[model samples]
Target: MTIQVGDRLPEAKLQRIRDGVEVVDTPTLFEGKRVVLFAVPGAFTPTCSERHLPGFVEHFDEFRDKGVEVLCMSVNDPFVMKAWGESQHVPDGLMMLADGNGDFSRALGLEMDASGYGMGKRSKRFSLYAEDGVVKQLNVEAPGEFRVSSAEHILSQLP
Candidate 1:
């Protein structure tokens, strides 16, 4: 089932490039923290690279000032995610995470088949606000659309 408001995020492990690919569990990452977790279909894709990720990087401080940690996830390896973050000049605080196997995406019911685009199984473009591990809001963009999941939109929806 798709995760909904009031639903606690499923337990899973995610990878980030810090300290040579550190692995973090969902509970530890979200525990007692207000977070904006946004997923892109794949790293380095046109819209994801040019707009989606950049929006979060630009507005990262706004979210931090509000005590929200911004996380960017993609169905790519940690190396690609790290390179993309570096290419985009992503700020220190915004996290670049990898759901390489789409396990986390599948667990959230946000995995989508992108084989038609030569990208196998991937994550849908979406953003969710979670506090202390429970979801408070979700914005999922339609296929080939980029509106609701943008940082400006997610920032505006903060409680």
Candidate 2:
């Protein structure tokens, strides 16, 4: 089943490249923190690069002002995600997380089959507001839709 608004996110490790590649355990990352996590189907895709990530980057300050940690996750490996971040000029406050094996997305029931597009198991576009690891609000887009998961939309839903 897909994760719901009241569910606590599962404990799974996602990767990021700061100094070098490192694993960030999901539960610990969100524990005792206000977080806004958004996922895209893949990194460097047209919509993802142009609208999805930029929306979050543009609204990052508003999220932080509300004490929310913003995160962008994709099914790509840490290397691609890191490179995409550098290309997009993503800010320090927005975390770029790599769900390399789709374990985290699978655990959350958010993994999608993108084999038709030559991408394997990827995540659907979605955004959620979680506090202390428990989801307070979730906006999961229908495949190919992009409205509700944007940072602007999430910011309007913030508590």
Candidate 3:
């Protein structure tokens, strides 16, 4: 089953690129924080690039003002994640994370089979609000839908 509110995130290695690629364990990222974590199917795909990511970038300050860290994750490599963030010009505020081998996505039961699309194992689109490692709210989008997981939606739900 997919993870839910009150569940602590499972342990898995996730990557972020700074001066160099850095690997951070899931617990370290979630511990002692309120995080707005969103996942996309792929980095450069149309909806992901055009709509999904920009939503977070546009409202990042609001999340920060509420003391929530914003994380954008995909199954791509750290290099690609970093490049994408830089291309969007918000590398400083958004935490672009890579799940490299889909270990974290599988553990969360949010892995998607896109072999027919030739994308192989990828993450489904979703977003969650986690506080100190335990989820407080989660929005898992229906396939090909972007309605409930947008930044505005999360912002509206924040306390």
| lDDT comparison, 1 vs 3, better candidate | 1
The CA lDDT at 102 in model 1 is: 95
Weakest 10 consecutive residues of candidate 1 by summed lDDT: 17-26
What is the C-alpha lDDT profile of model 3 across 1-159, one tens digit per residue?
A: 899988999999999987798999988899998999999999989999999999998998999999999999999999999888888776476899999999999999999998999999999999999999999999999988999899999899899
lDDT of 1 by residue, 43-149 (tens): 98999999999999888989999999999999999999999999999999899999999999999999999999899999999999999999999999899999999
What TM-score would each prediction reach against the true structure?
Answer: 0.99, 0.98, 0.97
Clashing pairs in 3: none
- Select the stronger candidate by TM-score from 2 and 3: 2
Clashes of each: 0, 0, 0
Which digits, one per residue and each the tens of the lDDT, describe model 2 over residues 44-88? 999999999999988888998899999999999999999999999
Where does model 2 exceed 4 Å of error? Answer: none
